[model samples]
Target: METSHPGTGDLATRATEILRELTGRSDAAFRDGQFEAIEALVKDRKRVLVVQRTGWGKSAVYFVAARLIREGFGGGAGPTLIISPLLALMRDQVAAAERAGVHAATINSANATEWDEVLGALRDGNLDVLLISPERLTNPRFSEQVLHPLLTGGVGMIVVDEAHCISDWGHDFRPDYRRIGALLASLSGDLPVLATTATANSRVVDDVAAQLGSDTTVIRGPLSRDSLRLGVAPTSSPGHRIGWLVQHLGDFSGSGIIYCLTVSAAEDTTRALKDAGWDVAAYTGRTDAEDRARLEQALKDNALKALVATSALGMGFDKPDLGFVVHLGAPSSAVAYYQQVGRAGRATDSADVLLLPGTEDAEIWEYFATASMPEEADARAVLAALADSPAPLSVPALEPLVGIKRTKLTLLLKTLQVDGAVDRAGTGFVATGAGWAYDAARYAAVAEAREREAAAMLEYEAGHVCRMRFLAEALDDPTAHDCGRCDVCAGQWWDSSVDAAAESGARKILSGIGVPVEPRGQWPGGMEKVGVALKGKIPAGERVEEGRVIARFTDLGAGQTLRGFLAESAEDAPVPKNIADWCITVLSEWDWVERPTVVVGMPSATRPVTTADLASGLARVGRMVDAGNLQLTRDPGSPEVNSAFRVKNLDGAFRATAETAAAVDGQVVLLVDTEIGSRWAMTVAGRALRLAGARAVLPFALALRG
Candidate 1:
């Protein structure tokens, strides 16, 4: 791929030609100065990073530049390596390009044989562009065995899409992105790299530049989209806001997405909407890849009218006809909200981005903030489990040791590997088996890092400054145009009395003397209208005596007191912290928060519990009783060991005796206890009990007997 006077004529001519072909507009037609700079850079062969928004012709910029490199230089001499973030995205790009007459192929970890073929094609100068992910490139084998050789021969350009991933400050940061700078240097004989992203503020630009080892040519277009109408709704529960969604959906013509924080919430909403006779589907991280494929196809084909999903559902998914995007859960930052809502209004016609504010959004983010990391003991347990297993253990298998969410667990494992605590082999991770030694100092370092990140997140969430300004500052862009599209921008929607009532309720519960509750968004009567007012404030006339409880404020005894229907009826205990966290969120959003509390955990209370608890709890109960009969008399401290006891074969007499003794008078109700699975089982049981009888039946014990 050799050319003469590379800085002048040939590169410019070819870039113009490609641009004309793609947009049916000549390079001269572009009034934006980007093309001139791009033309100059292609001739000088400098690394470039272009920052723009979605629907802006950013991809067209690279597509044209790549062709210039190909045509100006000799044929079959060098190839362009485009490091994309995802396989689906890579495939989509390749297919889209192929449709437009560009020869491109994907090389990812999942397709080694195809990767080998692609590498061979590149070596033979048959490939014009090769798309791969950063993860694949980081594999030493891919770098040493493939990239090093290709670049040494002669490679023209290296392009990184979604360049924001390189920034640690980005909302979606990938650890592998840290190596992209070094990767680009390796791929093109240290050739000039051009990075492109749909979203990047000044902070991301610096990070992308530093990551690419070049000063980025940041071409930031306006973030504003006049065609998109941004609206914020103050609702108590996401469920209640469905009416808003229904109203909008009825008014709108194109497809829509309702983003929930949890998989179950997505499913529940999908079901509820379906019951109401809406053509909708649900998507989450757990949705099988095949299902996602079908869903995407359905979306493209207009077979599905709407989709209820978590954040995982729509990445790299392109749907130009999308008209509405609903936030079933509150997002932690404005940037995230922007990205999700930006999915709609892809074309020219106006689109609707609806935010249904619920109390749980803050709490969900806090859960991630306070999520426990694997301690030294936990690491040891995890290592032991992995060491004992002949095969690699799935994350679920190690749940007993690392009690955390799957996403956090994955990141933790990655951190451990990077820190040399474990070695990854193929898809499964193998314990290094270096030694049984646990280093307190090393553990402290990791803990400190976790705490620092958590603190940063907390600050970002609770900041009183402009959301757009905060995002801009984080992105390293010191200057940012004020985006008047946020909760703070909209004035208080609640009434003064409601705000005062909310504050009084919160002060009644959480305040000591004069300290007021801090609210999330602007609320009337100061902090009174803020959802945090729901935390400590009790509603007037709300009282509890025995089983019949009076409800004034919904926040009191949130996770502790069980509400009973009648005096003789058994009361189900209060919603758990996780569930209450979701419910209070609902109340706060609706101005029903007599007392609002800052979100400390979980995203929303509307998220339903799972079924796996029934299996585990039933098993534990059966084992304990079986062991008690077998004389395995062990202390209660021993979780694995059970104690055996002997009793007279009396039933009614046994009950009378048990009732007469003060110590034994406690009812042996099958409470799920404060377990993750317990909440789910209780949720299921509570629902089942409502449909069945008033008799207190031991749900799990019966299953164990069965």
Candidate 2:
């Protein structure tokens, strides 16, 4: 039987003091569920799971519990350990810990130079709280040398923030979290644990609860925000959404976030909003770490009107006064949407939350949904490769043999390790020979769950239900009720019109073409170890020139149009006229140091017309000679893999005829493709032409895909 604390009045009074100190409010007191969570951890010393909305004092519970446990106020001792996914934002948490008079330290990538110092502090008992990231759990040395000691006795309580990740993305890309979930379940009962999240639905909640332990205490509350006024604006196209933002941004009271589904959409929105004279910045995965920190501070300072961002800015970014949140495209699940919009209306009396639904959202959703989950064949191939290897093989070395991309291969290996099929050996992996079975039934169930969540999102958009109530119900919130503040109940509060001039300008910005394709400066690492006969930098004399493409495949204007023609289901037809025209337009604007005098088409088994038309048309318009084709010796493999695999996949895949070589000799040659994905295809083709005596190679394509 689980031990229950007999008295809570003393613990609650002491907890109130810590809470007031943490929040800097003399009158501050625990919310309805906060005191209970703290008392359970501090007095009862049992596992506690708190499912509450953001800004409901989840962090306060752990911070106060750490204090009480350290002070022996609840018959407990030792430091508190927090595993947060928001590694980059750990600094803010550390600062928050200080305000409560608790000494906190963290060992994360952002503070790599201070790891030794932080670890020392932990061992010396000078630190009251230690924050860690889930990704760090993958490091073998840290787990063995550092984490092992702390879990043995140094940690009094453990807090898992954004705990839904334990059962959600953990199953897909983050195997470390899944493994940690198992580790947490095996913890000694006397060592208290707290798991908290604002986004978990009933399904995710149950999954997390099962991992925590059977006797875990669950404290759940209302997911709806009374201060939020939810609404959805009808916008058919990307331009219309951008135009709507440019026209109506002044209606909001203060700085906020504008969420985009993709990096390109964020950048496109940033440019459109900036062009229309709004103070904004783009935040995406590509944003530098330092720049992300700066942008977060700027947003908090209200120095900028908004930060147009992807999911990179999603969780753990706290700004209580955030005025509004507008989505350019809907997320795949209502739970995800609810978590994102929860960022707003936290401390404000009223905050605007709107969704501008796009026609392409479902397509983007399908693309991501497929990419996030690994196929069984890929997993089996990974295991087979590990079993075949005489020694441990790194992800890059394993990429070519297994034909799986490096990122996905790394994720798969971690999962295999967690599941007992493989073991981490230094930077590489070795087969454990434990004989793992593929959980096909579990994967199928997860797929079905995702589909149901996606369908619920569709219902949330147009089912005529109250928006807040729909989201709350989708999250399975027991306290959910119809909020009369939503657009469905109170009538639409935002205007749906876009300025015609602004719409045309946004279209122009979206349609603008000619994205520069930077040449690869060096060969990828671990190529020789994988048996690919290539190494070092491409000789300057044989390198391809800086290339150009009509647009990025993720761009809004020509990019979306390009997707329709290049989609998997679209046939191998002649190049679309609009695409050909865009190509000509991009070429006309090219200010090449030395213009090409000949064009060479790359052989394409799937897109012969597209390849030939682009090549012949460029030669025809530029008055350059057509140098025929670069023959395909074999399939070059998928261009979506990592650099090493991609580079090895294209080795000896292309060849040039002596006659075509003669035509290209001593002439600047224009290399053309329907799409310039990976750029390795062009790199290999260009090197072959250069080795055959072409003066220089310049690549041109309809779209650039990274």
| Maximum-lDDT candidate | 2
**Over the stretch 1-706, how does candidate 2's per-residue lDDT look in tens digits?**
0222325547777778878999999999788998889888888888889999988878888888988887776676678889988744576788889998889988765455467778888888888898998866776788887788988875788888888888863212256687677778567877799998988878778888888888889999988998999998774899888988999998888999999999878877897898789999888865544457778999999999999998888778889999999999999888899888999989999999999989899998887776556688998888888889999887757877887654467667767777878887765788888988888887687777778878988888894988988988978888788789988999989888788998998887777787666565566645775578777778887799989888876676688788768765568777778888888888888878898999999898778988898788889888999988899888887553556667777888888888898999898999988887667788888999999898899988888663
Q: What's each prediction's TM-score?
A: 0.60, 0.74
Candidate no. 2 TM-score: 0.74
Weakest 10 consecutive residues of candidate 1 by summed lDDT: 642-651
- TM-score, candidate number 1: 0.60
Q: Distance from true position, residue 664, model 1, in Å?
A: 50
Residue pairs with backbone atoms closer than 3 Å in model 2 (clashes) = 510-557
* Residue-by-residue lDDT tens digits, candidate 1, 390-485: 887666455544554445667666546544566666556778767655556744654454355445434544536544555455444445445465
Among these predicted structures, which one has the highest TM-score? Answer: 2
| Local error of candidate 2 at residue 689 (angstroms) | 30
